[model samples]
Target: MRRPSALRRLSLHRVMTHADYVSTHVVGRSLLVSIAAIAVIHAFGIVTMGVSSTSALASMLLAAGMLYAILAGLAVASMGDDLGQGYASLYLAHPLSRAEYFAAWMTAGPLVVLVAYLLSVAAPLIALNPSSMLDASVYLPVLCIAGQISFHTSVAVFSSILFKDKSKAILALLTVIIIAPTLVVFVGGLLASAIHTVDIMSLVAKIVGVFHPAVFYMPFTPRGGSASLSLAYGFGASLILYYLGYRFFKYRTDI
Candidate 1:
């Protein structure tokens, strides 16, 4: 006597609610601010430095990545506090699975970061010269930015879930802030040693070029070039961390 149609509709409705949780939390505000900041920087660079198309594009992408990483880090860190005691209790009580909640939280931060990337590059190009915007090179930078931000977001989410205590969470966030730059330096040194390049200055510059969020906004340097490998590494690391976080969240009680 009952129809399968109604059950399917209810299931779809539940899916929609879970997916929309991140958007409902206003994480997009961070992305909006990132866009505005990048636009201002682009405008200033053009006015002062006589920016070329390539330089402008690079700058925009760098600004977008840096801003999004910082903001997304902060947003994810405060997820628990923002939910409030009552809401947190209610969220735990809901029929939704822990994996679903974790996925939603993780997904929201990256989505905002992606939006920031688009706005950062698109707004500048639109304002300065729309005709020059369409190019294959542009996709490379965008992909790099997305991969970097995705990696950072995964770290932020994992840290958030791992540390429930406010003090501990803050410490974890600070560690993340510092470790990225340190890791880039170490990696650069290893690369330089392996290559045995005599040009110390060029080696130093190249070492600084690894696409970590900390030094992303630095001006033109050889180190900033050829980051596809670095980006891929970041993505791979993020996936590993995300999976580890999920397993821990499923069995652990302290979180």
Candidate 2:
């Protein structure tokens, strides 16, 4: 039999991605609640505190937190469940390869997160302060925030494939994103206290700043370069993890 053409395979992948989005739109609805919450909070700030760059930036980061917390695990749990339940085998039985299935999911999951994030942060901030649109400075932070969300999405997808179970994948993903960072800070604090010096906490904070998403919210600049270097790191690490997830899924995942 003739092999399927690359165009046909790509078309099938697109169709699969659309189907995943449709199926997961319920979860996407839940993301709307997050977006609404961000909008309401930002609106309240505008009413009471008035709009400022600080508040707008805070709201943007808040939206990123909400995006990571709400969608990360659930987005990829569907895939883990499919693998666990043998549903992936059904998909693989068709013209679709495992790589395409994985690609479809990776595309859909991030697409939902990105769209929800833009709605939650971008629309509200711009609407509240139309002048911000004229401000060239606003664009970089917005893109960086989106990049941060993409990083979280990659980690979540990798966790899902690694565990191959809904609950475990979600637990592991959240542990990495939230709990692990919190514990790092806590340890840093404890170490600083034990040493009777503030230096240890600063050192640990710097370490966390290197790897954790929490650092994205804070201000940091390396010796020579600007903060955009952090964005480069985030996107670069995400690509590595994304590929590792795909490799594992293609070679190791049974379904």
TM-score of 2: 0.77
Residue 251 miss distance in model 2 (angstroms): 3.1
Model 1, 203-229: lDDT tens digits are 454444443532332344424555556
Q: How far in Å is the alpha carbon of 108 misplaced in model 2? A: 2.8
User: Which TM-score value belongs to model 1?
Assistant: 0.65
Q: What tens digits encode model 2's per-residue C-alpha lDDT throughout 1-255?
A: 999854465766455664565355623656545555655564455434434554456454645454554464466666777778777777679877776777677656666556655665566566777777565455555565666667777777887788777788777667766777688889887788789745786566556655454354343421222346557766777888898998898778777
Candidate 2: segments with Cα more than 4 A from true spot = 1-8, 12-18, 21-50, 63-69, 134-137, 196-198, 214-226
Total clashing pairs for each candidate: 1, 0
Cα RMSD to the true fold for all candidates: 6.2, 4.1
lDDT against true structure, model 2: 0.63
- Which stretches of candidate 1 lie above 4 Å from their native place? 1-51, 80-89, 123-136, 165-171, 178-224, 253-255
